[model samples]
Target: MQVCNVCREQTPKYKCPTCKIRYCSVGCYKKHKDSCLPVQPPEPSGPEVKPASSSAVCTDPWSVEDLLNEDDIIDKVPVEKLQLLGRSDQLRDLLRNPHLRQLLRSVDAADSKEDAMKAAMQEPLFVEFSDCCLNIVEDGTAPTHT
Candidate 1:
């Protein structure tokens, strides 16, 4: 459990949207917000080389790698395989569905993610979305729809 960045006491239940700093309560947030600074990406160590793949260039400083590293899942999936997700037409098509998007948001925001995922699995659209992503990442090919 992460302690509040501001109070350094209680376990944090919320993260500041701007800086992504954890805080326990409204009071801690109020105290921290004024001094909060958005995290900047580390500067390149060498001469900047343009990415070979368009999908490799992220407009935001934060990338999927950062999120995966935070969750400690970076090693489970190769960066190459993860990049296939962006190139997947089937996955992109699935993401176009609003209901699937809502399910994804619910899963991401839920207090109990396991329970939320279990519920999401009950929906065929969500299952299809998951399968699409898996197919792309695992095989580097989109699932062909009939």
Candidate 2:
């Protein structure tokens, strides 16, 4: 059983094939997509090639860490594929917030992993807020301030 990253709920479930991050459900999976999407790697060079030799490095990204790292989770999506994620209106709005944009900029510019993660977590309510937005979008609903 793996623990859900968002809620920390423990359950047996499938993991994201690219990120190897486990989620209890689709809701939880989509919750992480915003942040997770940025880290996906680029596709391998050259046309889709098959190998007759065992020495060839497989173009498949997920296949490596499963055997190499054993416990570490790494995202394995192509860089081109990742660019499409930023096209969403939800993501665009989030990026428009000045503070968030600044924090994201700092995180991207950070030289250390620790600093990057710290910067990324600046808005502690981000995940929950994102969840609420997703629920609204999915249910064809909207929030009312009145």
Candidate 3:
């Protein structure tokens, strides 16, 4: 069964034509449509202008870490590390892994945050996801630490 991309609930009823995110309900689709636009690279207008240095890189305007600073109890994971999870292809692929689905169920069922984290880290996909995030940060694309 297809999972709703909005809430991760099973059996999404519709998929967005533009971004392809599957949604379970009309409300979810409407709520998510605005932000679900694709992240396409800007097209060149005329003759392409090249940057002086190949070292220049694209980066997110805001740090995900900064967004998490307001929550303490749930923010035990450092922003630096947490920031990496959503930036990589590895984590994207891991989402479809059946083993990860089980791991996530175990994580959500854990009584404590520590226990959830421990169980999540034990899964190979989580480890790979963490590594992918680290790679993104090291690649100079993530916003600089404050």
Candidate 4:
């Protein structure tokens, strides 16, 4: 779990828009906002260089890879597949449901994520949401469920 950069206590619930520093609460966010500096994008090196292998180094400072272990990297989905989730109308519609969103939030905030996921799986709406994401990512198509 990622601790708040401000308090270094609780798990962070939100990220600063400018610097992308994680903060747990509104108070922490308010405290951080005053001192937050916008992160500068990295400058490209002279020539266009390509990695010899598919295992290229991740340059983004705040990438999801930063949260993952080396073993997890092996099962990580490609950016192209993840991008398909955003274009999925089925996923957008599923996300519009407050109950599904709450279930997702509960799962995210749970101390035991595995247990939380198992509980969430019992909910039909949550299952549908999971299926929609899988359909989009795996097939690169929105679910045709009616």
**In terms of TM-score, which candidate is strongest?**
4
TM-scores of the models, in the order given: 0.48, 0.33, 0.34, 0.50
Tens digit per residue, CA lDDT, model 1, 1-146? 56778989987666665677767789998998789898785899999999999987655434454454453322367778888787776777888899999999998778667699999999999998888787777776655545
Q: Candidate 2, residues 49-123: lDDT per residue as tens digits? A: 677788664444445545444333443334454454444556556656787666656765565645676556556
Pairs clashing in candidate 2?
A: none
Give per-residue CA lDDT, model 4, range 1-146, as digits (tens).
Answer: 56789999987766665687778889998898899999896898788798887766544344563355343323467789998888777888889999999999998778667699999999999999888788778786655446
lDDT of 4 at 121: 100
Off by over 4 Å in 2: 1-74, 125-146
Cα-based lDDT at residue 122, candidate 3: 79
Question: In candidate 1, where is summed lDDT lowest over 10 consecutive residues?
Answer: 66-75
Cα RMSD (Å) per model?
9.7, 13.2, 15.7, 12.9
CA displacement after TM-score superposition, residue 88 of candidate 4 (Å): 0.8
Q: Where is the poorest 10-residue window by lDDT in model 2? A: 70-79
- Using lDDT as the yardstick, the better of models 1 and 2 is 1
TM-score of candidate 1 to 2 decimals: 0.48
lDDT of 2: 0.58
- 1 or 3, which is superior by lDDT? 1
